[model samples]
Target: MGIVINQSIKNTVITYIGFAIGAVNSLYMYPHFLGEDFYGITTYILSSANVLFPLMAFGIHNTLIKFFSEYKTEKEKKQFLGFVLLLPLLIILPIFAISILGYDSIASFLSRKNAIVYDYVWQIPIIALCMGYFEIFYAWVKVHMQSVYGNFLKEIGLRILISIFLLSVYFQIITVEQFITATMFAYLISMLLMLFYANKVKPISFRFKIPNNAKAILVYSSFIILSGSVANMLLDIDKTMLNQYIEIKNLSYYSVAIFIATVIAVPSRSMHQITYPITAKLMIENKYDELNDLYKKSSITLQIVGGLVLVGILVNINQVYHLLPKNYSGGILVVFLIGISKYFDLILGNNNAIIFNSKYYRAILFLGLLLAFFAITLNMIFIPKYGINGAAIATLISITLYSIAKLLFVVLKMKLYPFTVNNIYALLIGLLCFFGFYYWEFPFHPIINIILKSILITLLYVFLSFKANLSEDINSVIIKTLKIIRMN
Candidate 1:
């Protein structure tokens, strides 16, 4: 719990830093310098690369996190780490070779009548490899319980570099092609930084030794790779499918909307990084009661925070779209649906971590993969007609089904759930707060209106939350925050 708290604080700080930089880049710099087409190109390239990363890494990153603690000695850990490091090459090298060999066919298949993706297709494998090693090294650090630094580097450092790259384009120092190339360099630099941090935390030894658990590690990694691929597809298939069915320009609009909406899940993402190792440790020790408490508390806290973010987005979405180009305003509903889906994920708390760490984890992920397939199929069916909104609908339905399936599995198979009466109170208070703020228009400027509305909504939410005791944990946090601010 202490680690969760500390890491959550660190993650919150870094997330804001990333968001601040991202705000400047996305809101001002991207539109001002890159134009919407180039901006969309940038986003599409990264999303495409991310979708390929799981395949490149072959799931060894997740497998390492799950099994690293099982090793008893430094020598054993080093050998395990070495094996993990080497394992990706077996997949990435062949994939890269094939990509180069099949570049023409792949390009022809992907290039629609309106879209010309050939210029950027080559960068995908490079970005994938860089991202793959970054995750692998980051997991190396996570297994050592030094995740905060890695997360800061990942969440803040990478965005900061990208911001700088965008600024270069803004200053007329680089063409769109140069900016695209520089983007690959930024990822490489980020990966190198991860390696440097990994070395600083625990020097990587190149020793390889055969261990009894190596077979289990390989098997787990294989399944994890499949799971990671499915999860990545769940997140990115919409963008990819949209490219196939709609005009390329829509991808930029959808990407921006989705990015803003996904920010609501920041707290959940932050908590998951810390919770994963903790959940693994708990399961190792057979601490079901503490794990259950963690699950419930995390769900409520995440829901509270995520709900606030969702409310802010929903209430001020008009203002937000006004900040963007008029063309992107069409994505408002997309934002709403995706935002809700991400919040639903937040309400699940550490359900994913629990499932991944538990003995039944593989089966759970297999079920999730099946759900993800259905999601992709739905998107494929719907996006051609509904466009971005259809993508959002697919996401909403898939994520809802996925979360429910996970909950049911936890309840029936594990006999565990992450809900209580307080969750109901929190949900009710959140709805009231959203509704209360939704209709109340402030007599101020758009920015000021947003600020005032957010402050008032937060106040009402907090007041009712405390009155209802929706979360004892959050109540304590509010008290402590107030006390600290008062002292200041």
Candidate 2:
């Protein structure tokens, strides 16, 4: 818990930095400089790459985390790590070959409606390979119980580099075409840096020998790849499907709304970077009691933070969008729906870590396959009808259902529940804040109105959260914030 607390706080701060930069890019720079259509095209390429990443990595990233603890001898560990490191190439190389071979068919189909996408479609696999290796190295570090640097690289460093490329585009130092090329270059650079750090953290000894039980390891990695595809598809499929169903330009509008919504999930992402390996270790040791405690604690702690973020996004959404370009405001409903689904996702804390590490992980493959089909079906049906709003609705329904299914599986099979009185309190407090702040606004500049509203919401919400003692972790954070304020 101490490690989780310390690293999660650092990761949270860093994630916030990334989110701040992303907000500026999403809200202002991308829309203002790139224009809505190119922004959509850029987002489309990224989403395709992300959706393809789990495949290219062969799910070895998660396999590394889950199996690294099981090996006893350093020799065995090296063999396992070596196997994991090399295994993804089996998947990546074939995909690269196919992508090159089939580029014309792929581009023609994808760009039938949005011709702008055809020119950039080739970059998707290149970036996916880069991003895939990045996750593999990130998991490499996490298994060694050193996640802060990896988190910085994942959450902040990539975005910072992308900001520079974006600035280059903004100043005409690079063409938009070069900007896209540079974005891929940036990912490759980051992955190489992480590769260096991961090697430093735990140098993998090259063993020409494969790990014992290599068959089982490969089998598990395959299942994880399938399951990882499900989760990634639910996330990345929206923009891709939007390009398929509507004009690519609508994706830019959807991207802004989705970015605002994603900020609500930052705490879960931050904490999971550290907690995942911890959860893996606990499960390996059969420490059910401590694991259960962590499950409940993390659920409530994240609920508290995520709930507040949800409220803040919802309460100030209108004013925030008012500050954006007029075309962008069309995603107001998109933000709300996606934001709620993401908050629901946060409250299921450690559910993913638990399932992915447990033996029941394979069972998720079937459910994920069904849900993947469900997600795509819903998007196909709805996006054409409702545009980006339809995509949000499809996402919300699928994500909510998927989260509920995962929560039920953990509760039923493992007999571990993440909910408690405190989780309920946090949810209610968030709801209370939402209603209280929704109608209340300062009659001033959009930025001023959002600031004042956020401050008031923070004051009342924090006051109540402290009074109710919704989370001891959050209370500790509050105490530190207070002392720092006094010192300043």
Candidate 3:
């Protein structure tokens, strides 16, 4: 429990640092230096690459985490790592070849009427392959219980590189096309750094000895690819599908709004990365009581933190968008819908990690895949009529249904629930803060309005949270931080 809490805190810190860098790049530099269309192009390419990488990697990364603990000997662990590291090439190489061979057809299918998606399309596979192996190496390090450095490289290191690219754009050192091209190179460098760090953590021997559980690993990876694909569809399909029905520029605007909304999910993402393997180990050891306790605490802690972020964003969304170009403000609806969806996901806490680690993971994943398909269908139907707002509506509806389904499964099948009296108090306080700020008008500048609203909301939530004990983990950290400050 102590280790989990400590690692979660470390990862959360790293995620925030990354988020700070990302916010600057997204909210300031990108909007200031690049047009909305170019900004959208940048987001679209990256999102597309992310969606493709999981398929290209064939879920070998997840396979590493799930099976590496089964190896009892050092030699066996190294061999397993080597196998998974090389396994991605078997999938990536052929996919890259096919994409190259069918480049024209693929481009025609994916590009908007006047858009030249092909000119920049080659970078997609290159970036995806680079990202795919990075995950493989990162997971290899994670199974060794060396997650902090890997988390730094993943969450912080990648963003630092992106920040550099944004700075280059701001200085007119790179054209928009050149900056987009440079993205693939940045990912490649990050992946290489991850490999170096993985080697430093545990030197990879190129041994090809097959593990006894190799077959099981293969089966798990196969199933996880389906799961990964579905998750990707749920997350990225709106942006991708919007390109088909709407103008590329509009897709770009929607992407920016979604980016803002996604910041709400950062806490959940950071905690999940640290807790996944731990959850798997607990389930393997038949520690149901510990698992349930961890689930409840994680839910409460993440909800309070995530809810705070959501409130902060919603309260000052107008001010934040006012800083961007006027054209980008059309995405207000997108922000609301996606924000709610992300908040719901955060509220569900470790439902995903629990399900993924459970014995019934495949069935849970299948149900999720079905829900994701429903989301895609909704996007297809709504995006043409409502544009970005329609995509948001689809996302909110799909994720809401998905969350409800997962919660019911946990309750009926596993008899697990992640709610308590504190959660209700947290929700009520969050609502009060949001509504209080929502209707108020201050005679301050936009920037001051944002700062003032954030401060007020923070004080309100913190006061209420301490009174209700909504988050003991964060409360303890705050106490320790205050003591340090006073001593200083």
The TM-scores, one per candidate, come to 0.97, 0.98, 0.96
Stretches of model 1 off by over 4 angstroms after superposition: none
Worst 10 residues of 2 by lDDT: 204-213
What is the C-alpha local distance difference test score of each model?
Answer: 0.83, 0.90, 0.83
Clashes of each: 0, 0, 0
Q: Can you write out model 3's per-residue Cα lDDT over 1-488, one digit (the tens) per residue?
A: 57777888788889888888888887777777777777777777887888888887889877877776677899888888777766777778798889989998888788855375658777888888888888888887777777888788878888888888888987889887788888788899999999899899889888777777778778788778778877888888888777778777886688779879988988888887767788777877788898888888889988899989999999889888888878889998889899998988888877877786677778878898889889989998898788889989998999889888888888789988888888898888889889988777577899999888889889888888887777778788778888999999
> What TM-score quantifies how close candidate 3 is to the native fold?
0.96
Best by TM-score: 2
For model 1, what is the error of residue 40's alpha carbon versus the real structure, in angstroms, after optimal superposition? 1.7
Compared with the true structure, what per-residue lDDT tens digits does model 2 show for residues 1-488? 88999999999999999899888888888888888788898899999999999988999889989998988887788778877888888988898898899999989999999987788888999898888888988998898888889878877888888888889888999988788888888889989999999999988665667767889888989999999989999998999888887888898999999999999999999999999999999999999999999999899999988888889989999999898989888999999999989999999989999999999998877988899899999999998899999999999999998998999999999999898888878888988999988988788998998888888888888899999998888899889989999999
Ranking by lDDT: 2, 1, 3
**Candidate 1, residues 1-488: lDDT per residue as tens digits?**
77787788788778867877777777778777887777777777888888899988878777877887787899888888887788887788899888899998887777664446767789988998899889888888887787888778878888888888888876878887789899899899999999999999999976677678878888878878887887788888788777778777788788878888988988888887778888887887799999998998899888888888888878887877777778888899998899988988889989988877777868977787898889989998889879999999998998889888888888898877898888888788878877777777767677888888888887887888888877777788788999999999
Q: Model 2 RMSD to the real structure?
A: 1.2
| Candidate 1 lDDT trough over 10 residues, lowest sum | 110-119
The model with the greater lDDT, 2 or 3, is 2
**Prediction 2 global C-alpha lDDT:** 0.90
Q: How should the candidates be ordered by TM-score, best one leading?
A: 2, 1, 3
